[model samples]
Target: MKSRTYTLVIIALAAALTAGCASVAERDSRDPLESMNRAVFSFNEGVDKAVVKPLAKGYKTALPRLVQNGIRNVFSNLDDATEFANNLLQFKIQAASSDLMRVAVNSSFGFMGLFDIATEMRLQKHNEDFGQTLGRWGFANGPYLVLPIFGPSSFRDGLGLAVDSHFTDPVYQIKDVASRNDALGLQLIGQRADKMDALAALEEAALDKYEFTRDFYLDRRAGLVYDGRPPASE
Candidate 1:
């Protein structure tokens, strides 16, 4: 249910952002979404400082290889979804077929997690989404946006999230409310935990974290648009 709720919220956000696009240029620099993004960043930073770092140390301190394997599987699973969607959107029938094969094989053998054997079979993970594909074929991103609690996105991506939610794992379809919330929190925490190294690097290297995130987001979005093609230099 977490994914569904997230989807619904994203759809509502997409509608709001698209409908309010006309006024964004006129709005103050302190837009709510931007403010919320910054706030979440700061909050996440605090989380890292107070919680994530110590836990990472403890995890490494306790069960190093186990943590490593779990993280590997988690991201690998995500790649399957992305690769499959991208291939379908790009109209690459062969690639899409490979993606489905990977999905099916992994879902059963790997127990709903990606094993990354597909990449070894020469099929790469391609970035994609229904909205990005639509954008590439004709639809626009609609607007630059930073969705509340969801981070950076466009109206198109927000819609894509809504669509993508249906294919999410069983964790998203749990009927019990409290259990769903707990699962969602655990999932987000795990995702964030995996990003610790990246965050550390960004904190040290980037002159402007906001610019770094924005540029990175846009560049990543461009990858989705061009079906994994590298973006031209600005």
Candidate 2:
């Protein structure tokens, strides 16, 4: 099932790339698939409103702040492993060593990462991923894309996500299928809950939410690729 799903995603991305060439006047240079992306963005908003947002609200309401923090920490600890790998791929040895130590300290002294002892100990947390690594290796960012249920992404990041999900994500590596799925669901809900306030503010402030999201995603990704110092031309 996972293989089939991955295959479908690859096919969809390929199709999107090919179909995006249909020219539209006044389209943003970074998003030739504006029409398709907007439709997908609308669909994502509908799903979020009807299901994800409500669930996230309930999750926030039911969980104590400490519990939420702990859950977030645990997930962050798991992500450290991915960061470590990507840092190594990018030849960021110092950052990779920090990431490795973070996973070790958090997993052990932090009690399965329910506490972030590493951060308290002055070890900086890094967020590296396959996408940024690819960028460091000089891969171009293709058209902006809005994936169904996944929100903002681009061609390069979409491919990075696929690679991470299949290869690097610790949560996806759980041996038990049920446990892996539960972890995935919990992580999604936690992330959505965490972003509720920021997203609400965005919705209220932005005149064109879709454009704002796309630009923000692109700019932020570019910064990540260049270690917060994107080229002036970008």
Candidate 3:
């Protein structure tokens, strides 16, 4: 039933993003379903406070720095596959090559991505996603949304997540179901642990946390889609 709830949450966010709304320049004008988004945001926040945050804290306290770095490297190696595929789809041959090289080098010399030898070799890590692919092809971002668990996204990005999960991500292709699930769980806990201090600062600084998060996510996504050089608004 917990899985069902997560699905419903994604659906609700998708619906909101797809609904008709004003332009981005108008500031929050794109959020036609603000009420629903806020509710889901609160629900996600409650879940984080009650379960994810505590688990992350425990995980951080228990793990040494070296272990934590290894866990992050493992996930990043997995990300290289998705990033390479997206780069190819977006017609970025150079980036795709770099991503492929990162995977090959790390998986071989880095002991199955327990380290990041590629970075030391000056191989840049490029972030790409199906959402960015769609954007490059002229697909609109639609509206902003605050999805449960997943946090902020747009209609395009939400669909991209689905595509990445089913197609691009190697985690799903793992033959052993238990191992796949364990890898995913570790990735989640590692991510949450890394975000603890940043999240705390956000809570302390933002008077309206929802708005702050929404704007920040949208801006950051734009930066990612444009490879950190988003065009200035008119």
Candidate 4:
């Protein structure tokens, strides 16, 4: 069943990429599915407003700042394992080593990652994932896509997301279904709460929120792929 699901995802992503290329001449070159994307974006906005934003707000109100930070740190520490794997895949030995060290220090001295002792000890934190690994592997960022609930993505990154979620995400690897879901929910709420201020600023400032977000996401991904020094053409 899992193999079948993975096959279906690969097929769907390939079809989307092909369709995007075929329609590029009729729409924005980067966002060939602009109409469909806009609809999904609207749906995501509604869900965020009705469900996610309220939960995030309530979460922030209920938790002390220290507790919130601790939760964030714990998740961040777990994410270091993913980073380590991706960095190794990308052949970034230094980064992979640092990530491994961070995990070890934070998990032991920081009380199972409730605190970030690694950072204090001068070990830099790196944000790496299968998406960036695929990018580094020379996969083109296909047409821009707006995923329901997940928001902005691209064909390549979408596939990368599937791979990472299925194979590398520590939370997703939890053996207990209910516990996994609870952890996932907490992580989502915590992330949303952290981004509330930035989201509010974007809402207030952007003339076209969708375009702004899409452009920012694509640009940021490109920068990440190129290690903050994208080629002039990008």
Q: Clashes in candidate 1: how many?
A: 1
| lDDT, model 2, position 156 | 86
- lDDT string for model 2 (28-116, tens) is 88888888888889999999999989999999999999999999999999999999999999999999999999999999999999999
lDDT of 3 by residue, 54-161 (tens): 999999999999999998998899899999999999999999999999999999999999999999999999889998888888787876767667788778887777
Better of 3 and 4 by lDDT: 4
Query: What TM-score do all the candidates reach, one by one?
Result: 0.70, 0.95, 0.89, 0.91
Model 1, TM vs. native: 0.70
List per-prediction Cα lDDT, in the order shown. 0.62, 0.87, 0.82, 0.85
Q: Once model 3 is optimally superposed onto the true structure by TM-score, how far is the C-alpha of residue 65 displaced, in angstroms? A: 0.4
lDDT of candidate 1 over 134-226, digit per residue (tens): 666766665456554456676677766656555533455567888867766656556666677787798799487875786688777777677
User: Distance from true position, residue 137, model 2, in Å?
Assistant: 0.2
Candidate 1 lowest-lDDT run of ten = 24-33
How should the candidates be ordered by lDDT, best one leading? 2, 4, 3, 1
- Kindly report the root-mean-square deviation of model 2 from the true structure over all alpha carbons: 1.5
- Which lDDT value does model 4 have at 184? 83
- Worst lDDT run of 10 residues, candidate 4, spans 1-10
RMSD of each: 4.6, 1.5, 3.3, 2.7
Alpha-carbon error at 109 in model 4, in Å? 0.6
Global local distance difference test of model 2: 0.87
